[model samples]
Structure formats: structure tokens, C-alpha cells
Target chain A: MENSLITADAVEISEFPHLAQKYSVRGVPKTVINEEYVIEGSGPESMLLSTILEAVEKTGSG
Target chain B: MSFIKDADRPAVKERLRDMRSDVTLSYFTQDVECDFCRETRELLEELSSIEEKIRIEVYDFKTDQEQVRSYRIDKIPATVVSNGGASGIRFYGIPAGYEFSSLLDAILMVSRNESGLSDETRKALQDIKVPVHLQVFTTPT
Candidate 1:
């Protein structure tokens, strides 16, 4: 819902190195919070919010 | 997607003229295999031409082992967003569809060194002193 109207080119991720193996970046849009919390595949609104909160909680800062 | 066009170039150039801050769009692509590499490179170059403070740098994904290691990237078709002098934020897929806001947000955030997040949100993010990496992945839905 946040991104609509605009083309896909603006938000595309096109640069990554192979060492991400350590990060285990398995899927696209995989958000690792402060290298501490790992939010898996993108989920629906409710699930996404929960994941964001979980990351924040785990970080114990933001 | 082709900001390199004749008509649109002037507009972007005009806007970027007065803009303050140095931004770099680091484009990492492979030579022969990837599908979107060409298009992404084109877009970065075009965008760079539009903005004075913005510059685009392209690197080989497999061959540039040094850059790959330094940038901490593990995928192609990604972008490492740099603001002022700091370079680290990355996107692993096309930043479009619903993620455009995030892209523009990154630009403005880098330009201003502020996220442009709401007051409450700003308060929330300001406490970040340690390395804070936030990744959000999604399809163009």
C-alpha cells in the first residue's frame, strides 16, 4: 500500500556481493536489523508490523 | 525507467542544481548473465546526469572481489546508497512498485542526513548509534 503509482525501477535492489552467505540472505527484501534480528520473507500488513516490532524489541534500542 | 531521455534530463538537472549534499548510487552488475543489469545501469547513469551532487558508479559483481567484500553485498541488481560520505545501505532487488517511497526516502534521508520520518518516528530512530541495518523485502504489489 505504501508504494503504488511509481515504477519498480526506483526501489529495485541491483547490487550485492557473494559474502552475503554469512548473512544468509536467502530471499529478496530480507531485512536484518542491526545484524541482530532477521525478518524473513515479506508478509502481509499485520505480520510485517509484528516483524518490525520484533526487530525493535530484540535490538532493545530502536 | 530511462531517466537518460532528452526531455526529462533537464527537469532533474534543474532540481538537483540547488540541492545540497553529495549522493552516490553504486550500481553493481555482472557482464553477461544478469537480465536487469543493463537497465539498472542505464537508470543510474541517467539519474546521475540529472543531479549535480549525485554520481553513479558501476562495478562488476563477480570480478570486483574487493568491492564486493567492502560493500558487504551478496546479490546482484542491488544498490548501495551513499549519503554525504557514508555508504552502506543496500537494496537487493528492483526498488520499485511499492518500495519507491523507500528509495526516495533513502535519497532524501541521505541528502539531509535525516530520515524525514515523522517527529515520533524520528525520536524512535535517533537512538541508533551502533550499526543499525534495517532491510525490508517485498514484491511490486
Candidate 2:
């Protein structure tokens, strides 16, 4: 998974714009799964793999 | 304000019936004000009745701090669409207009326990280790 391009759109610039707001975003390309899991940003395949593994373990979601 | 026309209920319910997981929509709002708040509350209530698995819960925004805290809710007419998981995911402001599509997406995701995201989208979200807050803003059309 080469870093997915989930760029902050214009709303990010116009609505709540700030790098301090970066912490709020937590990380780029964050994808929320079932609203139960959230992946921060691009990482090594292992990182993403673990995130999925952990989310499944935690949520028991199909 | 029943934004969803009566004509549209059949399709929405038909689509919703495909869900295979437990789903609940928790609404937080104050009674005294906000025109959109009342509308949202009614819309969700009606939506809930469309199915048995689709449940609804309403709480006072000003009086229910504990409930609000549980969901980390910070806005009126806020909604937490959870798939029987821990709550906190919030849809701030009224989810009307195009944002309702997102609301429907969230409901389907929760109810199906399936997130059919692209591999690339999944890759992008696969390494988050912190609490990420996502706020999407839109105006009712």
C-alpha cells in the first residue's frame, strides 16, 4: 500500500485550517472502519496489517 | 421536516434490509432551540421505525452530559451511528442534504459490518495509532 492520497480538501483549508489542527486529524489518510477502528497515516505494510489485525480482534466485526 | 419523501421509503428500507448486523443511531440535542435539530430528530425517529434492527436513542444535549461525554459529542443535533460497538463516532450538525448520503453510508457500514473500501483507501487508513477526529461540514440545500 503505497501511501494513499487522502489529501485534506478545501474544507480543511477553509473551515478549520491549522497545523495544530493536524493533531486533530491525528494523521493523514486516516480511514475509519466501522467507526470502530482508525488508521493514522501511510505506513509499512506491517503497520497496516497489524492495524487490521487489531481492529478485527477488538471489534469482532465481519 | 420529513426530508425523505414517502415515495423514497421503500427503496431506503429495501436497501436497509440487506444489513446483517445490529445498528443504533443515538441522537443528542436540546429541546428549546434549533430548527434543524427538531427536523433531524423526527427524521431519525421515522428512519428507525422502518426496520427492527435499526434502533434509535435520543438524549438532551444540555442535560445529558454523561451520555454526550460517552460519545465525545460536542455539537447539537449530533448523531452517533454505531454498529453495537463503543460509541463516540459523531455526526455533528444536522445530517441533511448531501451529507445524508454519508449518513446512509455510515448506517450501512455499521449494519453490515462491512466496509467495502478500496485497497488503497484501506492502506491509507491502516496505520493510525491515535484518536483521529474527522469533521465534515455541509450546508443544507
Query: On residues A1-62, what C-alpha lDDT tens digit does candidate 2 reach at each position?
Result: 11121111101212233522543554334444434455555556656556555664565433
The digit string of per-residue lDDT tens for model 1 on B39-84 reads 6677667666666677778889899889788776667787777764
Q: After superposition, how far is residue B7 of candidate 1 from its true place, in Å?
A: 3.7
Q: Give me the chain B TM-score of candidate 1.
A: 0.74
Model 1 native-contact share: 0.24
Q: What is the interface RMSD of each candidate, in Å?
A: 9.2, 10.9
What DockQ does candidate 1 score? 0.18
DockQ of candidate 2? 0.06
Please identify model 1 stretches exceeding 4 Å from their true place: A1-53, A59-62, B1-5, B10-18, B96-102, B128-133
- Show model 2 residue runs off by greater than 4 Å: A1-62, B119-126
Return the TM-score for candidate 2, rounded to 2 decimals.
0.65
lDDT per residue for candidate 2 within B1-81, as digits (tens), equals 467788988887887877887688898878795646787788788788776778889899889989878766655667787
